[model samples]
Structure formats: C-alpha cells, structure tokens
Target: MLIQALTPADKSPLLALARRIADAGCNLSESRVSTIGTEVSLMLLASGAWDALAKLETALTKLARDESLRLVHYRTGQRGNSAQLPYLVEVVAADRPGIVARIVEFFAQHEISVEQLNSTRYRAMQTGAEMFQAQFTIGIPADIHIAALRDDFLELCDGMNLDAIMDPVKF
Candidate 1:
C-alpha cells in the first residue's frame, strides 16, 4: 500500500507513523519525506499480508483524526521491468518561470518518461544572484539516438542560457 501524509512542518509524525506500520506487521519498502514551505509531506510504501494491511488502514485513520494530518492511502502493485535506459539530466540557470515546464515538455515531445525530478530556486551566496537548479531522472527508450538527442537537448538549453548536462546513470 502507498500512504501519503501532510502536516504542519513543526509537527513531525514520522516516528509515530512508522511505529504504527510496524505494529501492524507491515514492512516499509519505500519512503520519501520532504518539507515544502510550511508543510511536511511524507510518501510511504508498505507491504504485508492482507489482514495486516487492513489493520494498518484502521490505525492510520485513527492517527489522522487524532493528529489532524491530511492523509491518503491506496493499494498499489510493483513496477515491471523496463527496457529503457536510465539517464540523469541536470540544469542550472538564472531563476525564471516556465523553466521546468519547458524542460518537461521537451522530454514529453520525445516520449521520454521522467521517473523523478527535484528542483530548487535559491540565491547564490557569493553573488546574491537568484538561481534555479533541477535534476531529472528519465528513462530513455533504447532505440533513441543518444547522440542526436544530446545535441538537441543541449541546443535547447543553450538557447535559454541554461547550463545543462545529460549522462547515463551509473550504478
């Protein structure tokens, strides 16, 4: 099952949530936690027997009501193996609106699937200049011409004055 929770940043219920999952005989398989602005967000995947999962659902419900957390959960299946190659794309540029949208659109046009993306905007400590940085983990179809794709991606970044790099993910 996949669970998501959102609460005020100052009130972290990570330990409580983990404890409940364990008490319900569930194994946490994956999790992502982040603080965005004033809210803390959590995404967790847990696996267990059907009865245990039902127990977890009940526990989570009570916890949500007691803690006033925004929570959602649903059952999900495992991901199948893919034939695409994993690549990482990184970009750093002057802070501007639409940068992420433009990059995502570029990949979408080529039928590339973005597995994960993390981006941030901050001021440079040295120069106080606003900057934007983004990292994308994408799956590129094996049949795609890498050389031509790289050239095209670089060309797009160059046009926007964004420094970028595209490289295969190494284990």
Candidate 2:
C-alpha cells in the first residue's frame, strides 16, 4: 500500500507513479483522489512489497521541483481492523470557490471525519445562478454532541448565506 499526498498542479507525476506501480506487477486495490484548493491527496492500496514503490518516490521527488508540488506524506503498510461511525451532512447553495475549504475546516475544527463527499454544480433555471450541492458522509465519534453539531452547522450556513442540513442517517 502506498498513500501519497500531493498538489494538483503536478498531476502528471501522480499518473507516472500509477503507471509505474502497474508496471511493477502490483494489483491496485483501492485508490482515492481529492483536492481542496491547491492541495491534493491520493490514497492507494496495492498488493506487493513496499520496495516496489521506491522508484515511484524518486520520480515524484523530481517532478515536485519545478511545479512547487510538495509530497506531503506517504505511508507504506497495511491497515488494522477498525470500526466506523456514521453521520451525514448535506449542503446546497450557489456555487463558489472556498466552499469546500470552509466546510472541511469546520469538520476539522469539530474533530469530525468525513468518510465520503460528493459535490456538484449547475446553473439554476430560475435565477440562472451557479447552484451547488454537496453531500458528506461523516464518521462521528460516539460521544459527539449531535445537537451542537446541528446548531453550529446552521450558524455556518447562515454566515455563508447558504442552506445546510445535517441529519443522523442509518448506514
């Protein structure tokens, strides 16, 4: 397993690494790529020796020079068995930059972990304005205060002038 953190500016480097992993006869088990502002994180799970990923590291290091891309972090190991907690949050509003950052920051501050997030944008027929909607599946610790989370989220929505709704979901 090779988990890499990178910037979106140097996508080619990531592609190159992926190709190398494939060529090294490794089976790609799981891969996820996401970005918030200029920061991009890639998590990949593969079946093979960690040594098979050495070349990938060197290639990414070189590619980071001119692109100002930073290899934020990497881990080579297997995952331990664990349990997951489930919660869901969804928001809809006019599309604009910084929305993701703001929401993610709030989650971070609240010590909330997002398991899955899907966001989309389109023009609204009535207003012809860019409308955005985001759905987030989060992991809430057993002790987290749900009512507090809801109140805070509503406050955030009011500040952002957007509509936000959070609910306890069965997963």
Best by lDDT: 1
lDDT for each residue of candidate 1 in 1-171, tens digit (9 for 90 to 100): 999999998887899889999999999999999999899999999999999999999999888885558998888998778789999999999999999999999999999999989999999999999999999999999999999999999999999999999999999
lDDT of 2 by residue, 111-152 (tens): 888888989888999889999999999877767778887898
Residue 137 lDDT in model 2?
A: 91
**In model 1, how large is the Cα lDDT of residue 6?**
93
- Regions of model 1 farther than 4 Å from truth: none
Top candidate by TM-score: 1
Off by over 4 Å in 2: 3-25, 33-43, 49-75, 78-84, 168-171
Worst 10 residues of 1 by lDDT: 60-69
Candidate 1: C-alpha RMSD after superposition: 1.5
Residue pairs that clash (backbone atoms under 3 angstroms), model 2: none
lDDT of 2: 0.73
